[model samples]
Target: MRRMLTVCAAVAVAGTVVAAPAMAVAGGEAAGSGAAPWMVTVAFKGDEPLVQRESCGGALIAPDRVATAAHCLDHVDPTHLEVHVGGGTLSEDPGKVVPIKGWSVEPGFRLIPSPVDPQDFEKSSAADDVAVIKLARSVFGVPTLPVARTAPAPGSTVDLFGHGLTQAPDPKNPAAALGDQLKHAQLKVLDDGACAAGLASPGLLDGKSVLCTQGAATVCPGDSGGPLVQNGRLVGIVSFGGETAGKQCGEPTVDGFADAAVARSFLTQPRPPLAPMAAADPVITGTKAAGDTLTCEAPKWTIKPEKTEYAWYYNKVDPANGFEFYLPVEGATTPTLKVTDELAGHKLNCGITASTAGGTILQYSDVF
Candidate 1:
């Protein structure tokens, strides 16, 4: 059976490689930062610089919001994600990093496993794979790309842009880096019958929710959530790719995107309540010595949380492994924790979990 990958947009996660549902410009030319000023770099907080953490690409659809593929963030925590906008050819520029406040995936979104091998993601496909992200603050000066009111005709040509792999990742070259510069490609829209005929999982393409395409140049990993533009408006988001003949690069297979028009309602709908966002980390006050009472204050949040909860933990030294580990104190759900002799010689810390209708977030304070 032929392989159809989700473009592997996400980088290594805790040492495991996950196929990201985005693509990059393969057999295409480099694009300037101005080429798509509304372009966005979706990334996670990591030890590396923001540019090095590029997971998926996105397009700014509102002053304080961006549109991307749901798979790129469906299982991800909003607090750990950030968007880089208004950058140069690079993944990020000075002062362009914006933390994600919250996000919502299309209610109907689903990922279909390959009939040949469920363990193999190279043959996986998706349905209704779109999402909208709320930024911590509004970004001015840059122009936002409006979602197309209707799907483009099958024979029409469209452009795709992204910060993804320039070519299919080689198994032999596992250390190869992802594309840092943005790039663009032109592809022709494919009709439903033509699209299904070329895909390993044709049943996943409903024609309305998916926009199919093909061309000499195509999208590779990291391009997921990147914009597919027709006449200056967003028509689709890079979703997945399939190989009918050649490799995963140029002219290799049919590509799929989350139809922007089909997702218009979810994209343009009124904003919902945002997940809890902390302005500061939790603070632990009081003496560290045993027999002293310690109080942990909830971190200030931009939006008031509906509820706040706390937990106390102690770092203990294990005599067997000689390694330190943390253990939660029993019934430490209040704002105060009374230290006892048993906690002596152990480091203590507090965690505050803030929750709202939108989502929940947990923040921990430095060890006391």
Candidate 2:
């Protein structure tokens, strides 16, 4: 998938449109049956500017971040990536330009393209197929979309937005245009029968987990790394396309695309790994309820945040093979855990000790 060719390419690929808006071709998974009214405009570093109309594009994932296909950044440098919002057109009033500060894709990305073989058809061809961009400054004048935690289950609907390979009033060669404005398109999920509609180009779809949709979200020479949103959450990045060879934008073989979990795995350094809870001195914030569920609470979680492992001990022992507590509990996610403590009519003492790849954040709770 080449970035300048209406898809993802460098350091590499990755948006959507909106009256509400529509975009096409990205992760091949289904989204919910709703429309995400958002999209973004991008500019390549050292390029003339957004004035060209098709320098780049992306999908909004946060107030200041846009998820994109890493391949699109190839040839170009991050220093040149800029976003524009408000009033819809890429044209600006000088003050409307929003520059990108810092961002990251998976560290395992490859700056080059992957080749296709007639024998085996798999999607894992290139090392660098996806990427993300963080705005250098907080964007104003535009509404952004949210990111989802996982891919939408099968059978859901997906929405897209971008400048597709729309022809000018007069027909011309596909490569004739130096600057092309992105177009908007919508694709409804097709059944298994339609998934394999056009497989002429081996570079596009490899058959597995493909999405079949009607209409054209096809090759737009410049729509890459756009956001695939569902339930108001961004779940996928436009990394690949299913257009025919020499075509600008093509219909997507896969209607929807995304597995949020897969993209998250690319984080070379994840928020330093969420600090896990260590067993604390026992605390029953509330007593057992009539439903036979005991209310349990843990002490405030405190971890210095270093390379380490965590262990919660109950009665001086790791409960449930170092998992479910040996004591009663309630439901909470942090150090002050609150899971229903099924252990009743038993006295318990709990505490924790955390270990890291570097060392351990040590704290022994009192034996309660």
Which predicted model would earn the best lDDT?
Answer: 1
lDDT against the true structure, per candidate, is: 0.72, 0.42
What does each candidate score in C-alpha RMSD? 7.1, 19.5
Model 1 scores a C-alpha lDDT of 0.72
lDDT of 2 by residue, 189-223 (tens): 45444544444333444333233344434434455
Best by TM-score: 1
lDDT of 1 by residue, 9-111 (tens): 2122222222222344334556654788888888777878664677888899999889988778664546667788855556345237876778767777777
Instruction: Provide the lDDT at 232 for model 1.
Output: 91
10 residues in a row with least lDDT, candidate 2:
10-19
